[model samples]
Target: MNMPPTATDAIKDNLGEAGSHLKQAASAAGEAIKGAGSAAGDELRLGKANLKAELADSALAGIAAAENMGDAAREQMDVLMDKSRDVLDSASELIRERPLTAFGIAFAAGWLIAKVARSSNK
Candidate 1:
C-alpha cells in the first residue's frame, strides 16, 4: 500500500536539508577566515623584516660617513702639524743664525709678560 506523506514529515525533511546546508556554509566561512588571518600574519612578519634590513643598511651608511669624516679630520690635523713643524724649523734656524738677537727678543718678551702680569695683579 502506498502511504501519502503527512505535513509533519515534509516539514521535518525540509528542516534537515536546511540545517545541513547552513553547517556547510559555516564551515566554509570559518576556513576562509583562517586563511585570511594566516596571510595577514605572513605579511606583517615580512614588513618587519624589511624594516629591520633597511635600518641596518642605514646604520652601515652612517658609520661609513662617520669614518670618512674622521679620516678627513685626521688628514687636516696632519697638514697642520706639518705646517707647525716647518714654522718651528724656520724659527730654530733664525735663532741659530742670530743667537744674540734671539736672546734679546726673548728677554724683552719676558720683561713685557712680567710687566703685564704685575699690572693685572694690581
Candidate 2:
C-alpha cells in the first residue's frame, strides 16, 4: 500500500536540501575570496619588482652623468695646463733671445715691487 508523505516529513526533506545548498554557496564564496587575495598578492610583488628596476636604472643614469661631468672637467683642466705651458715656453724663448733686456726688466720690476711693499707697510 502506497502512503503519502506527512507535512513534517516534507519539511525535513526541504530543510535538508536547503542546508546542502547553503554549504555549497558558502564554499564557493570562500574560494572566490581566496582567489582574489592571491591575485592581489601577485600584483603587489610584480609592482615591487618593477619599482626596484626603475630605481636602479635611475641610479645608473645619475652615475653616468657624474662620470661624464668628471671627464669634461678633466678635459678642461688639460687644456688650461697646455695653454699655461705654451705661454711659459714662449716667455722662456724671448728671455733667452734677449738676456740683457730681460735682466734690466727684471731689475726694474723688483725695484717697483720693493717700493710698493714698503709703502703698504708704512
Candidate 3:
C-alpha cells in the first residue's frame, strides 16, 4: 500500500506542473514572433517592388518628354533654315536684277565701315 504524501513531495509535484505551463507559454510566444517576422519581410519585399516599378515608370516618362522636346527643337530649326534660304534666294534675285545698284550699295557700306574703323582707332 502507498504511504501518505509528504510535504516535500507535494511541493515537487507543484513545481513540475508550473515548469510545464511555462514551457508551453514560451513556445506559443516563439511561434507568434516567427509569424510576425515573416509577415514583415513579405511587406518589405512588396514595398521594394512597388518602388522599383514607380521609378521605372518615371524614367520612361522622362525619356518620352526628352524625345518630344528634341523633335520640337528639330522642327523649329527646320523652319529657321527654310526662312534663311528664302531670304538668301530673294537677295540673290534682287542682286541679279539690279547689279549696278548692288555694287553702289556695297561701295557705300565699305566706305562707311572704313570711316567707322578710323574713328574707333582715334
Best by lDDT: 1
Name the Cα RMSD for model 1. Answer: 6.4
Candidate 2 residue pairs that clash: none
* lDDT rank order: 1, 2, 3
Report the Cα lDDT for candidate 2.
0.97
Q: Which ten residues in a row have the lowest lDDT in candidate 1?
A: 62-71
Q: What TM-score, to 2 decimals, does candidate 3 have?
A: 0.54
What overall lDDT goes with each candidate model? 0.98, 0.97, 0.97
Per-residue alpha-carbon lDDT of candidate 3 for residues 60-115, written as tens digits (9 for 90 to 100): 99999998998999999999999999999998998999999989999999999999
| Pairwise lDDT winner, candidates 1 and 3 | 1
TM-score of 2: 0.53
Off by over 4 Å in 3: 71-122
Q: What is the lDDT of residue 53 in candidate 2?
A: 100
Residue range 1-122, candidate 1, lDDT tens digits: 98898999999999999999999999999999999999999999999999999999999999999989988999999999999999999999999999999999999999999999999999
Residues 17-101, model 2: lDDT tens digits: 9999999999999999999999999999999999999999999999999989989999999999999999999989989999999
Q: Give the TM-score of candidate 1.
A: 0.54
Candidate order by TM-score, decreasing, is: 3, 1, 2
For model 1, state the Cα shift of residue 50 in Å: 0.8
